[model samples]
Target chain A: MATEAKRTRKNAQSGIFAVFREQEAAIRRFVRRISPSSSDVDDIAQETILRALQAEREREISQPKAYLYMIARNVVRDAMDKKSRSVIDFIEDFAPESVSSHEPLIEDQVDGRQRMLLFWEAVATLPEQCQQVFVLKKVYGYSHAEISRKLGVSVSTTEKHVAAGLRRCSDFLDRRAAESGLNETRRRSAGKGE
Target chain B: MTRPEALSADAPDLTSEAAAWLAQLETGRLSSRDLAAFREWIQRSPRHYAEIHRLAELSREVNILAGMAEPLKAAAQRRRAVQRLWSIPVLGWGSLGLVATCALAFTLLAGMPDPAPAVPEPVFLVTPVGETREVALEDGSTVKLNTDSRMEVAFIKGRRNIYLEKGEAFFNVAHDAGRPFTVYAGDRSVTAVGTAFSVRWTDRELVVTVSEGKVAYGEAPARAAPSQASDAGKVMPASSAPVSSPRTMLGPGHRLEVSPLNRAELVERLPENVLSRELAWRSGFLDFQDAPLSEVVSEMQRYTAQEIVIADAELADLRFGGVFRIGQTDAFFEALELSFGVNVEQTDDNKLILKSVN
Candidate 1:
């Protein structure tokens, strides 16, 4: 019985460590994405993880990965809210990778920089709503709570907006891929047809 | 929200569509529904996520380029302007606000200022309308007061003193040990040994709040504003021995207030981040927390001619919490309308009024 209790504690501790190692890079990316001050990236990353732990303690863990990411996202926002950098401007210059390098690898790796820029132009031109949501969520550093307060919307609304914006933005990228010569649609359809 | 494009046996022009959407996102504008729809579409495909990641990466680089070039471009413009002025001195004089503007431009390009350059004067500065004054202080605390605000520096032995006679101010108080610094208004004196804080005072009352560290606070002598023969002012006479009252300690979260009738006292336990809103004026951003619409508009009016008038008494009292970019009154009202579902109308008299809709 003592060993079992000890084991559970150990698992919880390991789980916490695994979560940090896994999400540290992504959270750093998120902070860099949103933080105006590059120097604050590490501090914000630390804060995001700490806040995620605090949040996890209060709630039941259904999906730890999603939950932890959500906490990290919120931490970014809370810091922003406290600092009041909620409003995302159009001219903000921050590479998404500077936001975080936890992005999906392109199977067809070309000049990494050019490919990324091509994609950024497409995303940058996303409708204003999509851009703001993506920026607020991805850059300019806001949690759903902070974003909602700044935009005068609800947390759910911010989430929905971000999700939808991501979906469309992803679709836009697929078209960009096709335009750039990769027949993503054909590839997807072939995978589906198989 | 726009529905996602269904996958046809033959692929459509996904690249153009994707580019358009990405462009929209980069521009930082899209309808709420559109944003939601886009996210949904992204979830529909692994390809979508890859593309977004790719695009996000690109945007990041673009931003870096822009940020890097920003200084060069600004410097180029400045050089050109200076060159142009060399040819034509008369054109230079037309740029009246150019000096401050150029200083700011340089600061942004070079990143933050050097500690000494950024270290402002300890003596507080006050500027009248259409006039600007910069002060070099002893301890190197730089204070910039907007037009019409009054500020004074007085050192009484161990205490560094500042009195906000009127209007609003931004205080970047240099950190120091040994001597405690305090800004006095009405009945409350906002005291700080280190870190930055802002104090705003009006004719009716005074407010002192802290941004960083803890502020050693005592009420300024809340005495009646010398009354005229005209309006009967509501005020309580303060005893000269009010200093005999016990000193009240104010931490960051505490908002200290004292009207003439009331000695400077801890009025509320506000959030420690209250300095976020108090010091916003420095950034040209005005943020409020359950702040009155009338007060918000009045503050806005201070910076611009466009006045916001509250139509309903209750609406006037309606609290708003959000950061408004300095001079972005239109965006401010739009957010208000979106949140409240109210109609904002511009009156003939040029006042923006918020009216309740059934």
Candidate 2:
């Protein structure tokens, strides 16, 4: 019930857009679950959100994140469908300067867990190229082929990056949870607080 | 409740399933067979079903997005089509967009005026064969629409222009210097500032003969079809060329003819009686002198509904000299039988057989 106030504030401030603003990060993460290429995640996220909004506009929806993830799942399939292409969609040298954040894409209410702070900081230390592929494939739902084509790498190279990146992030999460003496309760509460 | 390791293996299975589904989806015009296969695939596993449902949801979403963008694209495309339509010159009726629907609506709304312009400048007007027609003009003047000919007229300001689109018309143009009457035939517009002139156009030729007063000639672009008839009907004079090859300024009694395949040729100087020969069509008369017999039988067909057949090609080249009325062709047939050794016999249904009886 206390989180309700935060939800209303976020919703009231953004109007009909609150639903998408709330789940943009998770849907992107779901997209990464299938996509190994990080560059295409933002596009998939935008597409997923646009589609989700349309579904919402067309028919009232109760589960916003579920609906968004559903769209994200399809986007993942499409990204994978495009993955058959061995050639990269973008330039090999092109790299974004900013680190992608999995920190709650929506506003984090002050009364929530600070694990997100540590959670996202660990995400920043990843090797730039590996981090991007991992997020796009593992978090955003792009396929290994998509990551390879977008980053102009071999499919096997994309798979390695995604596997390595996720392993590194999981390791980081394990370490943080151990060092901070945090449990699933804290993680879930942290998710709820955000 | 499950560890993240379980989720890692799931990605490839999901990826492969997605690729397969997409390939099957693109197999051209969606069919019941495709749907049945898809349903079977969905029934294969709970995960597969879940994924298909997810994808179906995705396609639905993209369609809505495309829908939102459709109106904008349609409006832009419509604007472009209108710009292209405005570029055509045939309808100088103003404005770039005389939309077909709007034109139809306007025509209906503005009910057809009871009486349109009476002098219908037809796209093509032809006269009879072996017959010269003197067609009186709206003015007290007249133009002898020659035999087996066609002509086209277009009006521009004070200058009334006739494109002997094909065929010839001799103009007894009303004397008006303010507006030069022009006959536009193959490559040359014979202009009469206030004069009398004869201009004929064929598929491969065009000729102009001027009598009484000097006439200025302007050349038109060569046409595909040129004229075949001559200034003097009976003695066509070896398919006479025009009097001036370059169509130099013409004085009274000058003549010019242009072959479609060549530059203009100097035909002849007209005698004072030339007008009677050219204007004989006004009196329904056709004259022939040493003219090919072939041109005669062909000419015989037009006056009567009956078709005339010359049995031999040699008969066409044989020259004959005669003068007779053209409209009542049966009488002329008798005349031909009497003058030339040509016997006319009746064939079935509007057909007449001709024989060289001599």
Candidate 3:
């Protein structure tokens, strides 16, 4: 009976791995989209697969792809929480070299400043109410409920404004980046530069 | 690639769809069905992935720029002011074209004071009993004032000072090396450059709890030595005062209590659960773990106007453990009566009296 159980366990492990392998590239892309640091993408993806395998052993995962992505989101959240704590530690410990190394070069600073100017211009192009809602929700980190209460609008209205603002601003940035040929250079240098 | 051609054809719609998905995710209230649908949508096409990835990058960039919240806010206000100006039916201004209008706007803007980083009057923020408020400061810091709290905010050129007159408040201080944030409570003060901490001040004692970063808790140099005001100024400048009293450096999960009457200081490193429970009031809930009934009653009393009197000492000593919503006095009393063999009486004066059943 023990041997039979072991055989079934091995078969389940292979089955889960097979599914994970097929979706690994897409999973990595999803992780890269959500994670703040590039270095953490592989580790988070691996952790997600392991968690999925463990969960599959306990029960059948009806939608394996969605299950994997859900696990990936949770793993990313946990990693972010831990990373924030370590960031606090880094600030407290005060490593001069580590701090200096993170500072952008002069050219990068100029590039960042230009992009910020373009971003503000994009925000300026938004409608009046959309601009207000977007600023409150995105910049000040106000909740949708708070924005609705303060502005005397419904929460759903605020959500719509935020969505519209994001859509317009992203399109504006993309158009400008393409115009200046910055996107081409960025793609060549970093493959997926922000 | 063919992906680019396909994306160009449906770029606008795809971008809008991605943005809507992102906004939903930002709410942090997505149902399981929503997640499943989102997964299926993203996997439908590589173009979907590319669109979302681009928008997510833009979102992150915007978040980073949120550190300049004050300037961005000022800019938005300026635009609103211009629009308001444009709507006015000023004579002869209607003939001005867009360029002329912009020039006039610039001249008008030059006449006004610089709105960005302008020093404003002090603002007083208060929250009544059974209510809490969150205020975002001009400097990007946020303060959550608990029930019955009174706080005065004064932000100057180089300092951000908050006077907590009564009750408790939590501070999420923005990082500004040039401007240090300080909270003055009674004779003691807590200073932080960039950190998150909460301070509670009553008549007799002060409690400081640090949840993130670090804070320095010490006696206010100016207030502590009022007798030697001139000497204190000479010996310790406002910026470079070497505190005579011991300054406690508190990190995450550290709780410090100082009592003026006894001149006692207690520093305890609370576990994660205890720390979270202590700070749970921020979330509109009070958590108790095997605390005495009297302690629980007193804590609950902070949130309500009604008085709770324990008539029997034994009844007050009964250990109770439960999580309760703040200001739910009726439910709390009912629970006590149901489980602790206690009876609650309402007096003629609208006071609640707890009595032993046996």
Candidate 4:
């Protein structure tokens, strides 16, 4: 019985690691999306993955990627909530003078600006209807029904436009990140999708 | 890339499927099976995860852009104006073409229709016993309704109004300065432009607690102005007659308690620990800090179908402090009996009575 339990634990650990190997970049991106600070993004992503692994060890996780996303979301929410309370720490983190680590604060700022510009350009490249739908639903926080009513389109159509917009933006960024060779880990997983 | 269609050879079907999942998941109504399937789909390819992550980033970027772009803000304003105009009963079928044209031109025009209309028929939202629900309003606001609560939602151009008929609800009002969000519980209404607050209406009293931002809590509009009362039966705006009733503007960590007998609204700034304990219902845990036995019983009654009653009046004032899961009341009773030297007599009719130890 002990041997069997050990074997099951080993299997669960391997399965969880496999999940990390496959979805780590995506999970990191998910965390980065919600995190207010770029520096916290990596920490939040690591914590999210670690929590998921710990949770999986105790019980079965039939949907590991979904579980990972959920954890990442919660981690972001907790970070934001904490940041709201510690206004001084938040200000210090943004300031360059507070940096004790080797990571240059200026690089992060430049990277953030570059990313924002890339995102805006990608959005501009979308079809007119898709751009409007994406802006209304995503930027303005309108529900699908509201978007449909405002745009004089069906709800399904609004969703389709949003999907198209998301696909274009994702493809644009992924390709750019690949070309720049900035995401070496992401490159390794690129072939695994096939 | 400029054409958008040429950006990826990745099947449009997959992206659209992910979009459908995103839409469904945001509704807060996905089943466990759907969640499992979504996980499998996302894990099937790194590309899938990339798309979802990009969707999130795009959403954030759009919000940022919304702040920067004057036209986008105007579009939202026009949409609200169009919604208000559409709700008018007097503008019948003859104005349909004009309304359609106005909606189409919402991007061009910045503003119109300053006044808000009376509340039309409100849509009722209810949560049965032991069931907590999160409802996303037409406006970006969200309401997490506690167990056994009922609320009426009325969305028009001017303001977003929610009437809590009975029970407790937490409102996360989306920030819209042009239109204020108000939650009316019994005779008191909690109003805010952008804030997070909870309102609990019980037979004993009405309580409003602010978790984030600022909220004004006071008596509901006692009466509407005579000029605004076009119809006798229609629910007019509560703010119509801004009588100088005692009002309390509470920030974070502040709570307003109004009891039926005591006409004075008690406003208190609780410490962080105590404030969290008070709002623990937002999570699934109930945190009690030296609360009276009677108060604990009332709080527990909101979550469970079983009624807890103190048989002896003396035991009602006995102070108790502990953290208990909302769903597990039997464990709470067991702990009370073991530690506090109380006898629990549970009858078959879902009644639990606490008596002094013999």
On TM-score, the candidate that comes out on top is: 3
TM-score of B-chain for each predicted structure, in order: 0.52, 0.50, 0.62, 0.60
Q: What fraction of the true Cα-Cα contacts (under 8 Å, chains A to B) does candidate 2 also have?
A: 0.00
List the global CA lDDT of all models.
0.49, 0.48, 0.64, 0.60
Name the weakest run of 10 consecutive residues (lDDT summed) in model 4 chain B: B89-98
Single out the weakest 10-residue window by summed lDDT for candidate 4 chain A: A98-107
- In order, what fnat does every candidate score? 0.00, 0.00, 0.27, 0.14
| DockQ versus reference, model 1 | 0.02
lDDT value, residue B180 of candidate 4:
79
lDDT of 3 by residue, B1-358 (tens): 1125456676648878878876776666679898788777766665565556555545655653332232233445545543543353221212223322322211211122345454345467778887765655666677777888876675666767776778999888889988888887766788899998999986647899999999988877653322233323321113334433537899999999987688599999988668877887765456676677789988888888988899977656566655444544565776565434468999999898998653
Q: Second chain of candidate 3: TM-score?
A: 0.62
After superposition, candidate 1 runs with Cα above 4 Å error:
A1-194, B1-138, B144-148, B154-159, B220-246, B259-264, B267-269, B272-275, B288-295, B298-307, B317-322, B334-351
* TM-score, chain B, predicted structure 2: 0.50
* Most accurate candidate by lDDT: 3
Residue-level error in angstroms, candidate 3, position B231:
25
Segments of candidate 3 deviating more than 4 angstroms:
A1-194, B1-120, B223-246
Give DockQ per model, in order: 0.02, 0.01, 0.12, 0.07
